[model samples]
Target: MPNSTTDTYLIGDMKNGKPFNGFFIYPRTNIWLIFDFYLNGKRLFQVYNDLLTASMVEDTETSFTAISNKNIFVNDRLKSGIEVTPVRVKKGIVDIARNVNNFRTTGFILTLFDNRSPEYIEIRPIAHGYELISTDKNTIEVTYHASGKKLVFRDLEGRVLTKSKRFNSDHYSITLEKLAYTLKYRLVDAESLERFVKEQW
Candidate 1:
């Protein structure tokens, strides 16, 4: 479903497969939209409502507060899950909020993958972010540097997944479907996703 307000902006072209996620604060819908694209032509998505709150918005202010000094313990509920599983982070974290000046949009994270094979994800820390490679060869390189004013992403296609910069409403935002079409990849809308979301939720 398309968002109603023009207030909606895209935070996409992240990666097409497992463990790779692209996210942004989509306020107009007040719903969590999760998407995943896979190499074997599989796709997964989920949606949730009413997760946003004043506290979460306030926390976005600190989402990118120099993680180099602290080993932050992230207790996030994520999508349809009701539990907060704590994941400790020592490295390989890049908070987009650090680019308050460069990126005006705000959003939370979303994961798109069926809990199946390609069992694990490998993360190698780079300059500002990390390089993520899945067992199935799905690769994504993320770099966000506010100080140097550099923000780049390479997901799936070895080269930059995005070839054009259409919207800077948040410093580089594009829809996943649009990006797929631009890349000449098939646009998939799984009908069973609605039932899948319910099953997972």
Candidate 2:
């Protein structure tokens, strides 16, 4: 069972407890978990992977962003099947893209958490040429540029959840992950993520 190479496993008439495999990307780390009936059991697998991924990384962009924002979210899917939820959305500033002094890294972070929970998400740009797009619960998309920026949160039905405030300089950007928190929150910002990339000549 340890060295097995089967892509799929079946349980309870292919319906009950078959092993499931998935990956969770956090702001600080990227972790993978595999559930199998045999090797070390399911509980051990979850515990091991969670602990492994929770290890701190040097360049933690997501954790920094989350802290800057002051809110967090967990995957809605994990709420049903998995028992553990590692900081799905950090409450801080996510660097969407940067073109500062010729260096560029373009990406976005998806946040999650309840809006009425007395906490909000934040996005801050460490470098100058960064942009943030906030897609609130209402599914309305608003783009935030460096200067002459406004903050707005809308519901999916085109109703304004909240109005946008002008922002010239803020520390972070934020959003609430409704159902897709699991799909989006898996992007972690770490120093070692660069190592996984192949070098070019």
Among the numbered candidates, top lDDT falls to 1
> What's the lDDT for all of these models?
0.29, 0.27
Please identify model 2 stretches exceeding 4 Å from their true place.
1-4, 7-85, 88-142, 160-201
lDDT of 1 by residue, 1-201 (tens): 344421232343334443333333233221122222221222223232212221134446444231211111123212332111122123221111110112221112212233331122333445555444433334454455445323244444555654444343222223222222222111111222222223332
Q: Total clashes, candidate 2?
A: 18
What local lDDT does model 2 show for residue 89?
29
Error of 2 at 100 (Å): 24
Tell me the TM-score of each prediction against the true structure. Answer: 0.22, 0.23
Q: Give stretches of model 1 more than 4 Å off.
A: 1-115, 147-157, 163-201
Taking the tens digit of each residue's C-alpha lDDT, what string does model 2 give over 1-201? 223422233331222454233211222323223232322222112111322122233436443333211011122222111222224223322221111121222332322223332122222243322223343223323333556334345443455556532352121223322211212122323322221111100
